[model samples]
Target: DGYLATFDLDEYRAVKGGVAKKLYRYTNKRLWKRHRFTIGLRSLAEEKLGFKQGQFESELARSLAAPVAELQRFGIVCVIKQHGRMKQVHIAKKMKRKEAKEPSAPVPSLAKKLLDRGVDNAVELVQRFDAERIRDQIENFDDRTKNGNDVGPGWLRCAVENGYGFRKGFKPSRIVAEEQKVKSEKRRKAVADRAREDAELKTQQAADEEAFAEFLKFRNSLSENRRQELEDEALSKCSEFERNCVVKARRNDEIGMFHQLLWEQYIIPTLAED
Candidate 1:
């Protein structure tokens, strides 16, 4: 943490002087000032959600109940106008720079959305979110652009949500239907592929486990001196890849690479011993 602690006076000055004066001077202080929000809870609620204000004892109070309850659940507001316990809520928000504008967040990354949706299987993943369909929509968008073509239905939503491309028009229902069909096909394919991969992996793991068991039996049958001799022999016979893996595994306590090598077929008994 203190990499600079040993620096000499001249070296310290050389490092300290690296930052240019103009870069520091150009930063705008005025832009950092607090933003003023003029809209209050009463007006903003009514404007955004169509909430209405009326006498607490009147029939209008019934209409206000649900909207006010929803608004106050935001934690930033408390609507108590119903019980004649109405209190004013002042909203203060500063607009941010272009990159910082708080629009509804774009769909999260595939991994994040998958985890959040608890989608582990291909069917679940496809049903919850159609990644392949999104991809096809992107391709369609590209094809249309290349030919100087008009935007298709579902093009606008697809472009804005995923591709960051823009088109202005009402989305077509047919495009959505086409997207659903493509996703359905992809899910079926993905499920089959995943099943095949899992089967291959399990078969390989079973073979490895059987090989490891054989090695362990051989090791366990040996005397203490014989065991040490075998361990040293195994260590000596390690390939560059095996040695590197063992060393790294020992270095990293988080994962036991050395123990893994001792069981793996890669570090089996020597030819003479076998």
Candidate 2:
């Protein structure tokens, strides 16, 4: 038994950004037996790479650079070359020298599942098809194949070919789309909630500012004697320690500080009631 590591549809789909999918498809279709493939840059752009018409060679090369680098991370190497008026790309898979090894520890989960269903070439089948799709087919086969029905690998293969899971009114793509929609709705709701909270905070802040301004105006309109009486009433409500602090401020000739202390102790509370 030997383990072979290859990227399945899940890993391929998980790769994000910059024409990686196109690059993968192109390389995958062409580089199965051969290690290298050469294609016209213009043809690759228009056909496989999905670039728009009239794109210059420099632009295509620049765009291809990123995906080429990305594919390199997945063991594919690319070389771009210009020959007179023709620009071509060489796509190659990096090969490692094979050496003798010990027996594989255990079959992978997907292969094991295939084996349980009586597939002699479970490992080959796992490598050949999308793992998730295979798993889906296996589940569908299990559900449909009852005690009397055929529960063999042949039935499973037929189920996979016909896409029994999709035929049962549920598709993997549809599920993914629905999940994305739910996530998008949650994000939108979160943003709306944040905006509403911010607006409410600002409105309350404006109302508090207006009320404080009115309080200041009403106090200024009061006669000097009346204002002094109100200040004394406010000071009476203060604790002994607070009153001592106010006295110390007044003794230091800090008139602004003394007024602020009185406003906090008395005027602000009266304004709050109004």
Candidate 3:
């Protein structure tokens, strides 16, 4: 099989960094640029040498000579080409085919072939091979009933269940019933999983609402002295100019409305109530 050979300069840098630095000046510059070296390998030499029409092999040979030759020792052949502005290497394994011989025994029928392959159920075997045929028969029966073609409901049901075949010892109706039951179970499990996720989300929302209500109650119950201590703490956290800016920014909407209500309804009333 064809395989890729990648020579990472980082590995060489870690192992023989000093020696590599001394050999070439471009080594350090190229390492800093993060360039990677890769080569393709094939088993067949002729395929590697062969070039397609309108393809140039000489230019590729000039670009990848020493590294390509080095990889050949490991049973690898290389083919390089420029695809657009980027250069690419293709590798392939040398494959050989064996001659064919005529069969000496008689060819078995489809039913006999299935039985010989250890599948003894005739209805199951036929349905597996030609599922589209059964589907077409069912669809045709549905169309006939829709167009008033005198097909009784029982007849359509029997045709669909038995899959349009009355072979001896074939029980397609039972198989169809089992297939429907499996589909129903899969749908039921999916619905149950969705219900479980929705229930968990609802419980989390209720808990968040309760926590917010408790925080509002605690803030409302502070004494006037305690409120003054909070105001002093807030003032100490920032300069007077920053506090004035915050109060000015909140003067347009519900935030300003809340600030007014906090001073009037809670702070002033609490001092009077005390």
- Among all candidates shown, the one with the greatest lDDT: 2
User: Which residue pairs in model 3 clash with each other?
Assistant: 42-77
Model-by-model lDDT, in order?
0.43, 0.70, 0.44
lDDT by residue (tens digit), candidate 3, 1-274: 1111233232223222332233222222223323333332121121433323343445445534654553332223445766665555553322211222223444335333333322223234355545545444445554564665554423433343345553333334546678899999999999999999999999987986675565456545887577556544454555566556546644642233334334444445555676
Candidate 3 weakest lDDT stretch, 10 residues:
93-102
**Is candidate 1 or 3 superior in TM-score?**
1
Question: Which residue runs does candidate 1 get wrong by more than 4 Å?
Answer: 1-176, 237-269, 272-274
Please provide, for model 1 over 113-223, each residue's C-alpha lDDT reduced to its tens digit, 9 standing for 90 to 100. Answer: 333322222232334546755444445555565667655322323242334432455233456688899999999999999999999999998997886676667656778
Could you arrange the candidates by TM-score from highest to lowest?
2, 1, 3
Model 3 regions more than 4 Å off: 1-171, 223-274
Better of 2 and 3 by TM-score: 2
Question: How far does residue 221 in candidate 1 sit from its true spot (Å)?
Answer: 2.4
Per-candidate RMSD, Å: 29.0, 18.2, 25.7
Task: Say which prediction, candidate 1 or candidate 2, comes out ahead on TM-score.
Answer: 2
